[model samples]
Target: MMNILLLYISPGKTTEKISKALSDRFEADGHRVTRLNIGKPGSRTFKEVGSSIFYDMDLIGIGNPVFHLRVMHPLTEFLDQALPYAKPRFGAFLYLTYGGISSGRALLDLSNQLKKNNIPILGGFKVWAPHFYNRVEYPDIEARKTIDEFYSRIKESGYQPLEDEKTKRLFSYQTRKVNIAYHLANVIGNLRELPIQFDQDKCRGCNRCVNECPVGALTMQKIPVRDTSKCVYCYHCAAVCPHGAVICPTEKVADMVRTNKKLIGVENPQNAVYL
Candidate 1:
């Protein structure tokens, strides 16, 4: 049995679901699994997490939900800071959950980083899940079958390096045009900052937003004030507020939701690609 570390950052809980599924499957196969959700507030720091790393671990599974056609900020931060502390030559697999705006360059970007760290990339899995802006059913039968097959193959063959031809094909689908367009859109959206404004009348001075902020961007004053520079815009503060006291870019987000739904359509049996 292998010792495995399943590390991921999931704000909307889609990637968390996938990570849990993987952990359950690995444990069922008699492998020891340590699952960490690094996106939560007050979670372990990169140094703390790296210090606890088991050098004897057989495989590490790193996953995250794609945002703006790239890995989310917190997961990217983890990779940059903590991944190098892992023992050299440890096998690792990359998995991504994306809202239907094309996986774009997310997988390739992560694979390059892992290679630089001398971590072997066994394979990659890209699954489509509900968009954070709009809810939709996901991890349907086909997606589950793909996940099962992926785990089964890994169990049987240990870590199989993805072939050059397959990698080329996968990368080919992410066009330069799409990259430029998505990145431009992301820049414009982020420039707005989309700070969560607290309603003074509604806020009960509970400080839930301040407490739940993963980046410590929110602080309780007369109302919850945000430090835009420190915020990664994970939307946790907005989501966790109980009194609907926080307001974000609702019109822009709603427009995005409508656009994505129009582009991908809210169909059953969501699509996924495995490499």
Candidate 2:
């Protein structure tokens, strides 16, 4: 049993369930699991570097190779100060993410940083979930099988890394200016308030969302009350809500780049290039 930290970006329940299942299997196998859902926001949503160039650069390159650098700048700072359970012999760092124009560039950046810190990346698994804000496709059996395979890989000695050639090229930081332009368009369009919505009728007040939230954004009650200011919008609360109540009442970020004529080749929404 290895001490595993499975980092994932789960916009919906399928990936969260997969992460939990992986944790359960590892724990049952006598391994300790520490799961981190990076999709959720941390205490500080945005860090101020005091340069307009930072936002300009990131927005311009949003999902381009260079965009990862900009988004990673602040994240690297956070990781330096707050890498979880660092003393443990972290055997594998798995990334479960969806593809899109912006994609899991953040995960790639994080993976590189973890490697630099001497953590072995077992491999990353890309699962197709709902497109951004859409409902998950082919719910029951598909999700179960995917989760099963994800867990079974834990016992494997050497997991081959999965890469899509098109994804690598589209997301690679080949030209600095082009990357900046792509991210810039995304930033301007995505800057909107994401308000959390709860269906009181559906919520049983089990406090699962509260307990599982990385940030203490939920409080126990007949129904949970969210600390919007504290919430990172990781969508964990919504994804895990047993009653299927919590929701993000905002425009899907993908809508901004959906019209891009160049995004045709990226098959998976996860690999879509926003420019």
Could you give the C-alpha RMSD of every candidate to the true structure, in order shown? 3.3, 10.5
For residues 142-243, write the lDDT of model 1, one tens digit per residue: 557768888877667657666655654664454664566466556544653565678999999898877666556778899988887767666766777889
Clashes of each: 0, 22
**Tens digit per residue, CA lDDT, model 2, 1-275:** 44455444343445666667656766786866665554354532223212222221100001111121233233355455444324323233333334333433554565555556654444444344454356655334654565466557634634333333432443343345336545654554344335677778888888778776655668877778888765555556766677887876535545533643254223343322111
Show where candidate 2 strays beyond 4 Å: 1-11, 20-90, 131-133, 137-185, 195-214, 218-229, 234-275
* Candidate 2 C-alpha error for residue 219, in Å: 4.9
RMSD of 2: 10.5
Q: Rate the local accuracy (lDDT) of all candidates.
A: 0.70, 0.47
> Native-vs-model 1 lDDT?
0.70
- Give the candidate number with the greatest TM-score: 1
Judge candidate 2 against the unseen true structure and give its global Cα lDDT, from 0 to 1.
0.47
Q: Using Cα atoms with residue i matched to residue i, what is each candidate's TM-score against the true structure? A: 0.83, 0.50
